[model samples]
Target: MFTTRPGRPPSWRRALVTGGAGFLGSHLCTRLLDAGTEVDCLDDLTTGRPGNVEHLAARPGFRFLHLDITDPCAPDAVTGPYDLVLHLAGPGAPADCRRRPLKSLDAAGLGTRTALGLADRDGARFLLVSSAEACDGRGDDGPPRSPWDDGHGDTADAPDPIGPLHTYAEAARFAEALVTAHAGARASNAGIVRLYPSYGPRMRTDDGRTLSTLIHHALAGAPLTVPGDGSRPLSVCYADDTAEGILLVAASRSVRPVDIGADPEPTVAEVARAVLGLTGSHAPLEFTDAPERRSGGPFDGRPDGRGPDTGFARELYGWVPKVSWREGLARTVTAVSGCPGPAPATTAGHGTGRWLP
Candidate 1:
């Protein structure tokens, strides 16, 4: 639903996506290749699996580099005069962050620095796939407020940093600051994309996020579980839409953070029922005590506030989400149901199972 800016040639021809083996990252690689850009996908495989990108192995323009972005000489391995770099290499799932807090912090802090350095070195446009968690914390009550609402306008509106800096929320907030500082110093042409809930094909079954968990349960004919009162509202965007928004930001010259996702958010219970109907599973909906309930928590299963205000994206790039929740859920069910094994390690002709070191 968005068109490229007129009279300006698309700036990126050679691109690098830092988390290219993950669910959303893989979709991005596909989009970039479809646009004829040469893509170098960098993933450490800490949380990202190689099978997610196996389909892309055969594309002449696509290459996968297995390297941790936090290493001192990580950037040295990639040969680039790249036109764009998308930094998406951090742990986003709440469970993963909870299990490895330091790794999350380092990935956001050091990983972002590495990605920005690459962009600065190549004069490439840079984009950070930030989380909605970066927004100020909120309670599960009251009408949901948009990211651009009175109290949620910019990163400056984020909670005071004087307090303890742990947890994924704080880590992402710190990462955003790093990016803003880099841009302020005029080090790189950069933008930030704050993603809401995103789901689609190739989502890891054990990722422990709400949508994926429900789908996993439904497919197994197990009970779909909801935490708390199940009144929490969620605004989920399909993977393709999320990927498109990221690409739009990369192509734009804007430096402000843009919220990319859907609206008319659904409640957790609503989504659970929808999944059941789509999967034709007779599973009963069950409620259970949640391990922890924090706004934007992976298991929290709802937006902390109102859905994102995507007007900025629309005005800037003529972009908006095109997938309805019904259609999106149906597609996800089909994809997941058809997969007969662990994500295939290699597509027929894309490449060999062995990854590049």
Candidate 2:
């Protein structure tokens, strides 16, 4: 359990969220602030955009740090006696990893080490925001399962930690191992939450992922690009729900990895059609012969995973994704279609103590 107040939700006095300017990281930061937590959001801004969290700059309890976790000085920069430390820093989107393969490796390897060190110093409850891709590497055909494998007491063989895995999946496997080892060796309070695809507002439509790509073209009144006839099954959790599930795992004492994602398995074409309908775009679904490699799932190395059964989370923590795809997608459409976010007059950057607009 975390610190509790009379009327406010259970919260931490101060917390650190690495990759806070990122899509999911920003949501977690916002949710924490709403529950009365003083937040220090740290990001290198490599793939993360400052504009994502710039709106929170004026909030009294919020501070943004522009620092790379892999930097040796990064830990000292975040002088937090934090009660919660979330390691969400990494090249998460498929497009990001494909373009920045080496960066992806460091974010998981060195980045995880740096974040864990910060948490150990503060004795905070540490949570690594990982992806299901770390376990499910079936390319583009199969839906993603949780690392726990239905919690049937048996899990599939994890990707070889050595090699042969894609850049992102291999890095994820390495990060999870590092967290487990940290927990045993240092007695650090740590956990991992393996997320499936999570799409919603603040999600970059230009990421070249299936959902983002479809949304991007739909918003632009262009054809919704479909690869290989678009029959592969995929599912995504709403960003808010994913954030909440992550917080649940963070607040718990269990160090075991938990999966946080949706439960639907709609085909790719269905999802694209939904995007078109939501955007009110008359664009047709343009099927492409995007060549997919044997090992990589999609042509762009994007994995099309089936949704995992969230019963484990429901049983362990009373957590379940509340947003339906229709609703989640509609909300995403509204936000991406130029919905205004919080606009702070002036905000300060904690990393450099500089004034930001």
Judging by TM-score against the true structure, name the best candidate.
2
Worst lDDT run of 10 residues, candidate 2, spans 341-350
* lDDT (Cα, tens digit) per residue for candidate 1, span 310-356: 77778877778989888998888888786543333221222322465
Alpha-carbon runs more than 4 Å astray in model 1: 1-3, 6-11, 136-165, 288-292, 295-303, 338-357
Candidate 2 residue spans exceeding 4 A from truth: 4-9, 136-165, 288-305, 339-355
Q: What is the lDDT for 168 in model 2?
A: 66
lDDT of candidate 2 vs native? Answer: 0.76
Candidate 2 lDDT over residue span 316-342, tens digit each: 777888888888989999888873332
Error of 1 at 8 (Å): 12
Clashing pairs in 1: 57-350, 58-350, 144-306, 145-306
TM-scores, in order shown? 0.83, 0.84
